[model samples]
Target: MLSALRKYLILPKLIRLSWSAPKNRTVAWDRYWAGIARTGARSDVLWDSGTDHELLAYRDVLRRHFDPSLPIVDVGCGHGAFSRALTAYSPRVLGVDVSPHAVARASGESAGVEGVSYLARDMTGPGAGAGLVGSTDANVFVRGVLHVLDAANQAALMENLRQLVGARGTVFLAETNFQGNPVEYVSHLGASLRSIPAPLELAIRKLPMPGHFGPEELARAMPKDRWTLVEDGAATIETNPLMDAAGNSRVPGYFAVLKAKDPDAGR
Candidate 1:
């Protein structure tokens, strides 16, 4: 009875909190990243165990698919961690973010790194990158960014990315899917409720951000004719302790590889 109540009652409330979240996602994330920068903490620390593992997996995928000679763009590159990682494969890497503090920190921390640059710009805007649009082949990397935006902004960003990449471009995306696993969902929900204070928890619900989405939700959000889902799968990055007893330990998330559908359609 208790389990059923929690699943049917508490779970629905938690899900509703995400659905009705605020819409100013970009600004909220900018402030959040700025705050993190001010605290002198590396942005990589914000990644959970599952995310870290997924990143490693993605790196392997990148090594296989990435053309070493072409330039790579790291969209929503928070602190240049992924950009620096990409440097190992491609000499030319550009990291861009909307947060000035994050850009400053990334630039300062990676000052000595060669062939890698950081910029503070909103990729969704018209005047995002000067002289960057047609300078390189479109092979963009986006991690934990899409879900932060509302539907309109997400669509706009996708359109912008498609434009930046031009024809025959590829987009590698890593995002959290709350509907991936039941055990993982319950575990995360319990942890969040415990870690956050009551008032702050309420505030989070009102924050202008799409907390997370399911795999289907994400798939539906993509422009069908503009983008083709080439590859996708669950992120078995970590084990769920709650499901250990059942010998099922995989946590929930997803990664996808999308290609421009028409290659020359947007151009």
Candidate 2:
């Protein structure tokens, strides 16, 4: 009753105010993660499926592509889920997020995990990847991140990724490709107008609305002149289990493997 009221009536207004405010996406994300880390558990996050099935699947896809000797960086890694998973593929892993609370939580959860660390860095900000610029080219893993940003921020993030990966490393990105409006997307995921799920509600009330990302969006962000597409195909992003569904909820998604073209080659 009250939950339904908040989702449909109350939260819509609040989310609108948040959209209109001068807050950047990083601040919104910081507040969202901080709120969850303070009051909720991992199971409360919708996209966190509480299982490693998706990670395992991606591992298979990346096994042939990633160099085990190179370090891996997980961007937008909430609570270090993928960061911990990347250890199987690399000797060193660094998980970076915009929220300090998220970094703290990831670091706490990753206690005793060798060669794994967490840092709070907003990838869209000016000179965001400066601290991470190193001689060794790092393989990058990003999931469900680019679509949330507007065009400019997406470009900024790509620039940061360029710096992080340098010329020799590979980059893999997976993103949700829901081709509908917010209400339609939620409804397709088994939510009704009056009976929105709690995780979905939390996302609605706090986080930025997620946009779709497919091959076209990827091409725009990673131009052909600067990047070489290695492989890409259809994929699925798993979400938390839904009550009426047979298993965890699944969303349509895509993945791409790319390498930065050598600058000297074009010149």
Q: Pick the candidate with the highest TM-score.
A: 2
Q: Evaluate residue 123 in candidate 2 and report its C-alpha lDDT on the 0 to 100 scale.
A: 82
Clashes per candidate (backbone, < 3 Å): 1, 0
The true-versus-predicted C-alpha distance at residue 75 of model 1, in Å, is 0.7
* lDDT against the true structure, each candidate: 0.62, 0.76
> For model 1, what is the alpha-carbon lDDT of residue 204?
46
> What would the per-residue lDDT of candidate 2 be over residues 1-267, giving only the tens digit for each residue?
675443344445445534643256777777777777432233667788777788888877788788778889998988787788788898899999988988988898889888899889988887676666366778899998898887788878877777767766788998998877665566656665456567766776677778888899988888887788999988888876642243437888999998877633322
Q: Model 1, residue 173: what's the lDDT?
A: 80
| Colliding pairs, model 2 | none
Candidate no. 1 TM-score = 0.73
Tell me the TM-score of each prediction against the true structure: 0.73, 0.87
Worst 10 residues of 2 by lDDT: 5-14
Over the stretch 1-267, how does candidate 1's per-residue lDDT look in tens digits?
A: 685445444445556665665356666556655555221221222332223444677776776666667777899887776777778777788888987877877787788899889888887776453356355665788876776666666776777777666554578887766653432354443423334333223434544433565466566667687778877877643332332333333445677877776654443
- Candidate 1: residue 228 lDDT (0-100): 80
